[model samples]
Target: MSRFAEVLGRLAATIEARKGADASTSYTAQLLAEPARAAKKLGEEAVETVIAAAQGDKAGVASESADLIYHWLVALAACGVSLDEVAAKLEAREGTSGLAEKAARKT
Candidate 1:
């Protein structure tokens, strides 16, 4: 696997392991215990990432994107969604035009 995939896999596993941990000690646990809060954090990170990109700050974008992905994973876990399920959706979209796929979703 690519380094990116390997790191994300490890991060996801760590998040899963934090599910029932002490919330006061583990931020991931706190996020998992509060889905709404996790979602809000994910949104905040997303906005930061966008702001970084808009400013043409390559390093900032990369850093903010890492935060965004982490928060996104946490939000997904809090919502009981799995990475495999997300991958399945992406796999299903393979070869489909992005515009067509989006239009199909509007139905």
Candidate 2:
């Protein structure tokens, strides 16, 4: 598997393990209890990453991106999606152009 797929697999496993855990014992569980809140956190982190990129702060961008991805995985788990599914779609888009890809979507 590619690096991103490996990471996504690990994240998916972590999210699955966190499912049904006690809120006090696992932060992921706490977030899963309210997936919307976790999703908002991911959005906040994504904004931070954008700000970091705008300022040319590579370290901040990496850190915030990691946080964003973590919360995103949790949110995805709560929504019943798997990392494999996402990876498959990404793989399917490997050779697609951005404009064409967007236009081809069933919107």
Residue-level lDDT tens digits of model 2 in 1-107: 89977887788798899889999989999988887888888888889889999999999988888888898898888778787788899999989998888889957
Q: Give lDDT per model, in order.
A: 0.97, 0.87
Which whole-number lDDT from 0 to 100 does residue 13 have in model 1? Answer: 96
Candidate 2 lDDT at 51 equals: 97
Candidate 2 has its poorest 10 consecutive residues by lDDT at 75-84
Q: Taking the tens digit of each residue's C-alpha lDDT, what string does model 1 give over 13-105? A: 999999999999999999999999999999999999999999999999999999999999999999999999999999999999999999999
Best by lDDT: 1
- In model 2, state the lDDT of residue 22: 99
